[model samples]
Target: MQSTSNYLWLLKDILGQGATASVYKARRKQTGDHNAVKVFNHVSYLRPYEVQMREFDMLRKLNHKNIVKLLAVEEVGSTKQKVLVMEYCAGGSLLNVLEESENAFGLSESEFLIVLQSVVGGMNQLRENGVVHRDIKPGNIMRVVGEDGQSVYKLTDFGAARELEDDEQFMSLYGTEEYLHPDMYERAVLRKPQNKKYGVTVDLWSIGVTFYQTATGSLPFIPYGGPRKNKEMMHKITTEKPEGTIAGVQHRDCGPVEWSKELPITCRLSEGLKFLLVPILANILEADQAKCWGFDQFFAETNDILHRSVIHIFSLQQATVHKVYVHSYNTINVLMDAIFRQTGVPAVEQEFMYEGYYLELDLAQQVHLVPKTTEERPIILVSKEQKAPIGITYKEPDVPTFPPMFDLISDANLAKIVTCAVHQLLRITKSIMKCQDFILRGVYWMLAILKEECRKTLQRAATLNLKLDFCKSTMMRIQKIYGPHSRMNQSDGGDVHMKLQLTVHFLATISQNVQNSQKQLDQIAAQWSNTNDIHHKDSTIGKVEVLLEKVSAIHQQLKKDRMRMKLQYNDEQIHKFEKLNMGIHAKKVLALVREDCEQKYKKLLTCVKDWMRIACDIRKQLRSFGEQCESLHCDLENCEAYLNNMFHQIPLKLEGDQSTTKSTASTVYPDQKCMEMAIRMKQLKQEMEHVTKELQQNNMIIQSLSDGQKPQGV
Candidate 1:
């Protein structure tokens, strides 16, 4: 092939091929610079000479960055065949980019904005030049990567293009079937042979189809097979407006329309962008040319979207969602500052995460350019500091004083006095010991049960965390092996990975809390055991026992003194001696024992109050752990189901793509680790229920003691 500049062009590779011509990746011999060359076949030469020169004339008249530049027009050296040389677009057509697995659903919001801007700019250039690109589709749009790594789409393949004002009409049938207008489809595809004259509004219909497909990865209108096989049905669905029929879709030939004004659920664009885009789609997708939007309105609406502030939703540790408005030019630092202001977390302590990766504060990183999807979880802002634990306080009950000791000397009958005093002392000592023993044993049992539950709960949480880690590693490996274009590298995969990470982190936190509770239980158990030993040796109950023995000995001595006075002395002498020795000694000893018992009983009350406080703490800890376990259980279930669905979808997605590797089969089934986690979750739930019942019983025991009622054993 030869160019008009006398430069020899070597066709190194075929870039693309169409019905009339084939494009090649050609290199100039002198400069060795790559360029795209279009070589038309003999079929194209059969057209009228003026029709053959139309594309060249259109390209020479248009000069815009969004339109592909025409380099040189040449001829084949042997066959005198005409050839067109155009500037090379390294990024290729937009269709090839959309064919990747990651974009099977749609382009991300940021990426969609780029396409919108580029296409609108190109169309505006066409309007200014009075040119109509009769064949406007994804295949005709070329992508060029700029120096800053940004994509710019340009219009190419202008073979069917011509100069026509908006009001002018041309009776030409050209364009792909799916993107064609209903009137054009009737004539060109259905072979109905209608003489309908097409105007500039036909391009608007094509733009609407292309835009919808770019945003949602599927065509808007539909029939049973496709536009080719179901020609009449496709034309009717696009043009007819029954009483209850929607515009874009129908279930069957006479079935009700199933279209909605909102975008499909599979679209990844945000609700904010959807709000702006739907109105535009509704106006331009109209089959009636009179109702469709003109180029002026289209440019105005698209430009408005480009200049508006970006909206982002952030969640603070999965607790609260905050809506923030950011300009397109703002940096990540500014976004972090905004989060700090809204969440009250210090900027230095805040860690922002989008998808599964932490966001860095790079100067060149725009806040609005983060790769996020509507179906994915919100951006998470986590605090570096630990939250304070929830706590409950209890008021200590007032101590009780020992009852007044009986005055034996005041009683006229000596035998009765001894019996009453000895009986009262024995009863008091037995009651005190029994109450102490009951409280000690009850508290010890509760502590032991709580400790055991903590241990079991921690073990289950550890197991679940391990399973989560395994699943996450497997997902990461799949992404690595598939490269960036695979379905595993999309935003959905990031969402799954982020959810798994969150579950694992939560399990680790709960495990740490359970361990802390166990330590507290151990401390309470050790303290109760020490108190039990003291009860047997030097506690208030032991002191009461010693006092009972002393009282008995005093009573016996009094009886002996009474017998001696009756046998060996006169009445007056006996009365005087009894008053001086027996009465004084009995009163002094009884007063001392009563004082000692009162002090010991007060110490015992303090100890029991301490135990009550410790028990309340344990109950609070148990309740907290149970709640954490419930949350972890829910997270694990969601993560498991999401992973299972992802695994099932892998094989189906791979079947459509011939370029995928065979290793993807390894991850196409549900993992055993998720099932193991499910089993552990069930066991953990049962343990939680058992612990709850034990806690209720413990509360009852504590409440009874607080009311000063005797325990069952006592």
Candidate 2:
């Protein structure tokens, strides 16, 4: 007998009944649209039907494709059987698709991604509406093919969801057996304390199972024969891993490949799907819900694993450590006390030693300054009526107390201080001794380690002005070889170069911190830069005395290392080697500089001297050539007079001894001789032209070499 209906009359279409609920295929009479209706026996549940009906209202309001819409609800007569009529899927649920693929025992990697996006989208919407669907599974998912050939997944049923609290706490339990979180399973089986409260992480567990099925096509845990029988079989499903004894079955031992010989159903999935899931998967699954994680924790833990994996993959880029025996302060005497009866290295336990010691010291010292339960010793109240007036009520003066011997300056604090100093000194000593390294950073091997150590100590330990002498020397070493043609110091170029500026900054920051600490001391030691002023403003000589003692201790350690150096190896030998090294270093630099300087100086000096001498010699050559030209002009005139006299004499002889044709003979003689002379004149002109060409060529030769200057002449 169904009592009320959200829709006017759709409840009459009951088509079937199952072990848990009744189902029907109904048509919305108003729109002629088909839908599936489910009737639940909400009568015997802890929550009332109204709670589920309200969730149905929320679903009905949503209009996303990937969400199942609750169209209407019908409530049964007083027994409170609630009914939900929801949108119908044509092809069926994703569970059927997984069972029907070609190689399709499971969804392929690509198909899984599409389905995952849909599922996550629906859940994200639910979350935005301030809800957590405590139950999520393949059965809860319905897939429909769109006209666009795309597969759509819809999430349904939020009966057990809870709204989160302001304090970030959520608790809920409702889902199918295979997808139920370990936390909810505990809540079902155990009475109370055994089932701890959990949060949205429960939804994540279901999501993990969903992803596993989506990828590999099968549930990681499938104990059959209904939820109760499955619950019995869960001891194996949840607790017993396929690997080994139950000790640490949840956490697998990593190997080179880090894959198990037997694969999880998820492992059988495609590689692309595995990649999509890995960044979000928490490495270990635990029955203890507290150890499980929400999304952020899942991301953090996965990132940590991924980072370590990268370091292992590219081990060459990361820092390498050797298995050397470095001395630690774990004394055998301190190891005898066991906090619990366990067997392991007591390193974390040893930390408690310092904590306990400091705590005890604090308690003891505070007792001296501040009283605790004074009546346990003695109590006498002064009365005004008896011995004295109220202001002077004490008849007898009480004894004044002074600080105890060790209370003034604690050895534990001093020890802590000394331990730090010892480690720091050891670092510097190692750096200083490796002079052959001459790397600017104390010792190059310890460079990164020391810098990080100093940074932590200064920043975390509140230490000021640690020694940076080694860092300074390291920079100088770099500066010494900074020029061209300098030999490389380290194999890795400038990356690890420990840039001098960075080193200086580290040292300078340290120095500033030290100066600041000194100012803090000045608060006590104000106006007392020198000794003998022991007023309230200045530190007492006694305190100064203790500081001097610590300084002396540091000095003593340095002296001991020096002696150790000598006794272990001869001082003279080390001194000689150091001197020889320094000399070789200076000599190499000097030789390179000297050679370069000498060559350049000689070249420049020679060029200058040659130019000076050539300047004067050029003037003298010009004067001499001018004089030669004048003498050649005079010789040419004398030659012309001799040729004229010869011509006149020859004509007179021809006139006296020849036939009576004197004028004609003269004309004929003149023509014959002139022709002969014309031949000779042509020859002379050729000779003059040849000589002129020779002169021009000589002048060009002089002009070319004239640019080349002469050395100073004698």
Candidate 3:
């Protein structure tokens, strides 16, 4: 795809070719430095150019050592070609390295770990930037040889990469069949709608399969198959057991099928390494996305298994045992110094022992790791004169040094608090539902009491309508039930007239007190309801209810006007005018008392209605406060400051009043003082109203008696 040019780069021999492009070893014309150029033919190679440009854009944004660097993109007009210049990797691809080794089985365990760590580091970086490399296989990982003849692996090939938005799902199926996650296979081949959407978890599955193949020199699941065999392979990938070979089987739909025999990877690994890889593989290969290992979780598990390991060091001269925790990646000199501090010996004088032989100090100092036996056992340390022991046994002791306070502090951020608050709110909401149920029961109790009062009032009114003889008989029957202690007795200066006057005055006083207290409760309930409505303006339920209430009010006003007009034009009218007469008979006084009792019961009903409404309003206020607090807690930086300021502003204590038995069951006010003062003020006002109403009723009764007629019916 290149023409003769003397500009920046001079193209040389072709290195590799793909379906869309070819990579060539090129040298810089000015500096004579080597680099690789991926040339794309503008005619057919760059077909549907959007996808190609997306890959280029992703390459330009990536800037990590483990990720390949893109130097420049050049467009040659004469040749109709586009070329991308990238960092030169002299050691070729990791797949080539694996293939070059005999049967891909010569890679040492240490080298495999190095490769895995580098790839994982790169993948983690990509994830942090919201880029998912959907295609992650061995061929995409390239090895770059440094000036010192050591090689470092870097991830390449971003053709299948995608940038994801927050919480977004990637639905396209485009990865290698051999390395495809089982879910991806289900979407691409089986065309399953349920498996249509997946995310970055698929990348981990590819890496797991690639790791399995690299370690055992065989694919975990075979890639070759006909239609019937393909179905069998798909089923095997989806539901196969972990510790078994994936081989072709003779299906009923297909004739006898045969495949090559391959040893399971676990069989080839040492027991210790197998223990480490087994769990990692299980997590990575999990079919459920919810259970799959995240990048941080997977790395933490890997470090605990492979890097952070404990060893028992037996001291022969001092006759003491010390436990040493070692990181496998740390240099042996570091391990030796750790052992020296634990045993009170100098590093230079310490000699280490393995299974059957002593380690040379010169070799130990230069090595990067504390040597382990093939079985991965702990190493032993002894003085120069002491002989090595045959058996070693020691218990793990507690660490002598505690961590610094700053290090002990956990780094839980706002996001974690948000998650915890969600669960806490769920529990609180359930408790609130139970409280509401109890309140409903209370409402029903009040209704039952009111119903019984209404039934008694109706019976009393019916008895009043009966003949005068029946009324006398009923009064005698009531006296018979209560004997001489009945209040109806005219003896002992408690006649029916006096008792009736006292009863009307008492009923009036109670009604006034109830009405005043009900007004206070209504005021408080309205204030809280208004605040809740303002706070929840964005809520759909609140808005819809408000609209419905306005509509109902207008409809009621129209209905009232129409009924008023109809009554104005009626042919007949009913009217009753009561004139107070001072002359009161004993029978009429009893009737007055009965009517007063009914009015008192009606006032009690109004008090109960007001209390129920206030209770509901307070509940709504508490629910609103909880929702707001939950939102504030998510903003961790300002949550504590805001709450502290609110606390300082609210009045906390009442003046010169201390009573521990104050009712706190109604509302959750900012402080006890606010509730206490409000209740005390309402109680004082109610007492004054009660006294005033009693005096007024007594004056009206006296005036009616002064006029020489009975008082008006209550």
Per-prediction TM-score, please? 0.46, 0.36, 0.42
Looking at candidate 3, what is the lDDT of residue 504? 39
> lDDT tens string, model 1, 1-714?
445343455455777888788888777667878888898988888888988999999999888988999988887676678888898898888887776434655677778889999899999999999999988898889999999999999999989888899889899888899999888888988889776788998998899889888887778888767666777888888887432222367566666666567787556575557767888988888877887888889889889888766534443322333444456678867867766665667777665555445555564688668655332345555455432211111121111222233223332245324334433443444434544444454455556656766776775665566456546655664565356786667777778777777876777777777777777677767777777777667444444445445544554544555555443346434444543443444454345435654345445556545554554565566667677767766776676566556645544554454224323443563355445445755764565465446445544554455455654643
| Pairs that collide, model 1 | none
lDDT for each residue of candidate 3 in 270-359, tens digit (9 for 90 to 100) = 333544566777678666777777767777876665465545555433433344555655567776777777666677767655553555
Candidate 3: stretches off by over 4 Å: 1-12, 42-49, 77-80, 189-195, 223-232, 239-270, 303-714
Ranking by TM-score: 1, 3, 2
Q: Where does candidate 1 have its weakest 10-residue lDDT segment?
A: 390-399
Better of 2 and 3 by TM-score: 3
Q: What's the number of clashes in each of the models?
A: 0, 6, 8
Model 2 scores worst on lDDT over the 10 consecutive residues at 310-319
TM-score of 3: 0.42
Q: Per-residue lDDT tens digits of candidate 2, residues 527-614?
A: 1222112112222223323433444453344344445443334544443343333333333333332354223323323432332233
TM for candidate 1 is 0.46
RMSD, every candidate, angstroms: 47.0, 38.2, 40.8
Enumerate residue pairs that collide in model 3: 581-709, 581-710, 582-704, 582-708, 582-709, 583-708, 583-709, 583-710
List candidate 2 stretches off by more than 4 Å: 1-20, 42-46, 49-54, 60-63, 74-82, 101-104, 165-172, 189-195, 222-233, 236-269, 283-291, 296-714
